[model samples]
Target: MKRFLSLALCASMLVASASAVSAKTYKMKIHSTGNERNQSTPPLRQFAKTVEEKTNGDVKVTIHFNGVLGGDRQATEGMQLGTIECGITTTSTLGTFDPRFNVFDLPFLFKDYETAYKAMDGELGDMLEKACLDQGLRILAWGVNGFRSISNSRKPIDVPADLGGLKIRCMENQLHVSTFKALGANPTPMSFSELYTALSQGTVDGQDNPPILTFSAKFYEVQKYYSLTRHVFSVAPLVMSENFFQRLPKEYQDVVLAAGKQYEADVRAATENLEAETIAELEKTSMKVNSINDENHKLFVEATAPIYEEAEKLVGKDIVDVARSCLNN
Candidate 1:
């Protein structure tokens, strides 16, 4: 009887040790709406790999790409609810949570990639991240999506007047709608999942997006012209649930945040270099690529100026001032 009791105690101790090991292992789900080959995908994959390596595989990240789980907005909602751990989505999509995100949608806000990067990596970025935290989401890093340009089946858009009467599909952001309206296009906010069908069925005459997006999504198949408007420099945000992040061990948290910064660098490099290549590829598909001259671009700038004012009211004048200073500096 003494021997049997000792054996039973040993078995119980082994089970407890196994349970403790299991508790230390964490698996996180990350969702993205882009394809596997997208510019954002490489960095995201790298982030996962780095985190696993840094943590010695204590933390694992599983990515769901091409909207497998749901669209961007839905994925964000999932993150907030703690149903999903992380997501990489556009600022426009995230505007649904905080209208302050719409500030990025202000037309011609970013002069070039360099200026935009400085703003995102500096104080303005910190402010935006804090705003997300207040809403129960942690902003891991700012990911790049490149500059947004117009693509259409009807005609080339070189200036604000050319966009007149064009029905353009935009993300569900108030600033996007206002900017498109200012540019003379009839803006219709639609979900990204339904945009392809809407464009193919002539429900929308045009849409604006980055070259990588147009090529990867095959928007060139239905579109005839690609205009280099570079109206809005877009940013993709890597976000995690604040609740989930707080629950992580300090060492695991450090691994994840460091990985996020590295991923941002990879994403920016990939997105910037791929634009010219992707545009060249799209041209081979019979899409006429048009570059807007500086004179005409000034007209577009003027038309969308009111959008900045509206956004200032929503975010704050100080934030807008800082962004403007970034542009000037």
Candidate 2:
């Protein structure tokens, strides 16, 4: 009877210990609009793994991709509402959350990856991040979305005039809408989740995205033209709910921030490595690919000059000047 009682006590203690460990674990949900296989999602998965390993399984992360949780805008809003723990959203979408971020959305704002990263890692990034924090988002790291290009079923876009009257799907940002409007294209703001179907059904003529997204989302299957517009170099932030982040233990919070920094490097590397390969894959499809010549590119730059003025009015001229300074420096 004594032996049996001792064994039972040990078993009960083990069960109680297991329950305690489970209770101590923190659960985080990360939302993404892209599919599981996209360039952005894999790095996010690595981030989750690193966070778990570093935290010794005290922090559990679950990634919801393919708009499973919601679109970028919805995910960011969820983070604000404290319903979502984390998510990926473009700076363009974030402009709605804090208009100061709209400066990144201006046409031809960033010339290359180097310029964009410089801007984000320096003064401009600091200012914008603080603005986001005020709006209830804690930006953990900045990742690449690649330079955006135009894809359509209508025709090849060799010049700004090529965009006239074409119904293009744009992100829900005033700058993007204003950009397409200036090009004479009718820009329709739509959710990322609804984009593929809208294209397949002929609801919109064409859309713009990084070549990586164009290939990953299979936009090539529905669209017949791919133009190397490289108009906007897009960057996305891996963001956490300020409320959720603040609730984490200090040690776990530090782990999360470090993991996010690693994620930024991983995502940037993935995007750069896949960019040429993705464009090559697109070329192998039915889509007609074209690039603008220097002269025509100048025309595009000239055509969108008014966007800077509009951007200044929206994001403040001081911030706009600061972004331009990034290019000069």
Best by TM-score: 1
Candidate 1 vs. true structure, TM-score: 0.91
lDDT of 2: 0.90
lDDT of each: 0.88, 0.90
Q: Model 2: which ten-residue window has the lowest total lDDT?
A: 320-329
Instruction: Write down the TM-score of every candidate.
Output: 0.91, 0.89
- What are the runs in model 2 whose C-alpha is more than 4 Å off? 1-23
Tens digits of lDDT, candidate 1, 1-329: 99999999999999999988756877899999877788888889989998888888788879998889898888999889999999898887777788777778878888889989988988888888988999899988899889999999999998899999999999777788999999889999987779999999999998999998888889988899999999988999899998899888898999889988888889889989899899899889989999988899889989988887888887678888877777576
lDDT of 2 by residue, 223-315 (tens): 999999998888888999999999888989999999999999999989988998899889999998998898998889899889888888899
What C-alpha lDDT does candidate 1 achieve relative to the native structure? 0.88
- Give residue 317's error in model 1 in angstroms: 2.4
Clashing pairs in 1: none
